[model samples]
Target: MADFTYVSTWRGFVYVAFIIDVFAGYIVGWRVSSSMETTFVLDALEQALWARQPSGTVHHSDKGSQYVSLAYTQRLKEAGLLASTGSTGDSYDNAMAESINGLYKAEVIHRKSWKNRTEVELATLTWVDWYNNRRLLERLGHIPPAEAEKLIMLPSETMIWQPEFTDKTLSRKPGAVQTGFTRHAVSWGVCHPNIYYFHNLTPGWVSFNGEKPEIAIVPQSLHRLIYGPDKRSSPSLDDDLVVNLCTSEHLLVHHPMLEGILLSECERLKQHSLANKLISLFRQFGGTELRLKLVWLCWLDLMTGNSLDDWTKNLKHKSEKDLEQWIIARQGQSEPLTNLMDQYVLMAYRTSVDAAHS
Candidate 1:
């Protein structure tokens, strides 16, 4: 469903169109504009189209002129969507979109006095991120829209919020220029016990995007400690300590594990500012040799002995897309990841007790 609401700005009243998924109550697409022009609404629809690429869906909206516009109807038909408008003066037909608009107004618009379109735009971006990923909905079992989406095996859809708008951005007037690609990426190289785990067991989790050559940053956390939130300069590093990850297999396995402990400990101490040197270098492309060398390292919870930050599973995955489906199907309905690892220990205890009693 789609709807537009007016936002108060010093320049004038800006209009924001929101298109949300009814099933998960996830805001799929949104655009802030100076006017409620047909082009602005089309921009919102474009965002939704590329982000999700849904096949068989209904595009429902109120009996507004924009919704009934010829251009809008043509676009909907081209996308193979059935356009449905509510009967004249029927309020309930577009209640879902109205409900979302009401929340967007009360929560964000009413909270601040805006100066211009840019302020409202930035604020909306932040609020939408939180709303989809963090805000809980009572109807969705108190889970965020993202969690609810995963539970229902909905295809994960993410709108890349670019700092600058591309050719897709609509100006207040017609025939405005908008143009861009998502360029920012981080590569993490992990050290797993079984280097070929992705190749043999969970191949689906890996994508072969040989974008860059192997750039090793041993004790991966070092990258994050430096370039991550806490920026720190590194002293002259020892080549032997870094090369040992290749020559000395033992160091390769244990060194990253030690770093993992340090990272976890940093959070435990809550004095990250004092220990800013430790950071994570956490992005990488899937490859043949790297997969063999990559290791998964973690500090185990004393009670459970299960590797903290590690997911235990026995399965074969074919591609990155397949792994996404697997996660949605198997793990989405399970208890979410928790900061405290004691939950796994309790789970183990209960399973043993149930088995012994049976």
Candidate 2:
């Protein structure tokens, strides 16, 4: 909330506008001017913007002509601030700002007589510095606003470990195929028993009805455009074609694409709520690029025909038991594999909860 009060002196009356943070009661921005122009409020707001570089901040003020003017409203919008007005003649609406105004009047204006506006301005500069950095208020636990801010902005501690679901409950079996497609399905609960539309289809998974008819995996729009007139039969249904369905469908759906398919895929994956946890984990471990890298890795894994047995062949210990042990050992470790593992674990927990409710 913000408000400006007048300082009377022998020279003239100086209007001082202040933008106060409601929560901390800190004077974030202030501007002293000779007249009460719309710029009077805008200058203070500008100062606050430069100091905080805030986004989605609310600037609440009274319905003064200065605040309601087009220039002032435009400035607020440009700075990404939400401009709010209190009801006219209602003290309670702007009580926080009013309270600060009252304190300023009592502490500065009434304390001593000033010769000119210059003296009042100078005195205000000194007083504001002391108020924000040195003044201790009972409301702030007798600590200065600067100190309170430091405490509030400090980083929080890391999360402690907690296991919410077991392997059996999540329907994850020991030594089961741990392909990229399976990981994605388990993590997101996207591969349902009924609704089997996939962003990417892999080995050993059938369509919803299991008819296995030749499916033309095209964009819904293209399907409409082609069949609306031709009434043509879908193209030959083959495993290779079915395997490419997801990526092909994505390209068809997002027609007239200007950029790479990988970017689109990455964005689409992130939109899923379950995928968010995986994205966050990647961000924490690796930098920003890791999020996109992990997505591409999943795509690459999906493209590969290699089975777990094949992958385990050249390992230091090559037995089936050795491969399973190695897989378990690497759980929650690093990128790509770690994200995939986390996804499966989460999916298992979700499945258990859904089953219980159903």
Candidate 3:
């Protein structure tokens, strides 16, 4: 929930906005502004986004003018957040926010009279750090919110995201709206539809799927568009192509043209900054499948096109056609062969994640 409270500073009344995560009772984002405006809340929301990167969370706030403004709502929609407002004119509807405001009033605002917005801002900066990392909350088993969040951090796949709409269960929180979230409890951020679709599919996997006459069109769109498809990839069929079919059912479908198309797409990605996308995929995927990820790394090498140097140092540079014959033989392997191969893929992924963060 987000709301602004006025602090009695010497110059005048300065407003401070708070965006709290109801789960841990953690203040994920906040801003101390000289005036109450939409940007006051928006900047704090952005801070929470940069910090938490949550997906499918609901943001509840009162029907204050700033919260209802177009800019605020549009920003929520852009972040894939669901927006819910408490019924108008009822202070009890946003009881959680009201309680926090009371806490703030007692803790800092009433304790000392700030000389200016600068003093309040600085104090808030110190207070927020303390609140997240140290201050104990009775609701969270008397431990600090940050510590509580650490306890709640479930595995990514098993983490249960909030429902799409508001209901009585959410209302119990009484104004637990989220403009910003803490990543400790929920970490999913929006990924591009195309990247999520194409990142896991190898050319060999696509080839095997393409051999099925009914499924051939799916591979074409996933491959380099230069090869073309009878029907292009769209939202409806992307999930069906990936999840519905069992890998064990397919014979590694081969096409003389597939290797060329995948080469073109891989090289195209490597030439542009989009090649960095594979690194983004690294954090989410458990690890590479079989040696296909290895093949992909080889494909990315401009000097040694399709050479299995890292995985098989014995064989020097290998041509695309030679690599093709080798890949055809290994598609049936159920599991990745060596732990060393997984380490290599994981090492590359970690480097990517670290570089991007730095």
- Candidate 3 similarity to native, TM-score: 0.44
Give me candidate 2's TM-score against the actual structure: 0.45
User: How well is each residue in 162-278 modelled by candidate 3, as lDDT tens digits?
Assistant: 212223332222111211221211211111122222332222123111132122112312233323332232222223332221111000111012222233333323322322332
Comparison by TM-score, 1 against 2, better one: 2
Clashing pairs in 3: 59-177, 59-178, 60-177, 60-178, 208-253
Query: What clash pairs does model 2 have?
Result: 170-348, 214-237
What candidate 1 gets wrong by more than 4 Å, as runs, is 154-358
Provide C-alpha RMSD values for all models, in order: 21.2, 21.8, 18.5
Candidates 1 and 3, the one with greater lDDT: 3
Off by over 4 Å in 2: 157-358
Predicted structure with the largest lDDT when compared to the true one: 2
The global Cα lDDT (0 to 1) of model 3 is: 0.48
Q: What is candidate 2's CA lDDT for residue 357?
A: 17
Q: Each prediction's TM-score against the native?
A: 0.43, 0.45, 0.44
Off by over 4 Å in 3: 154-358
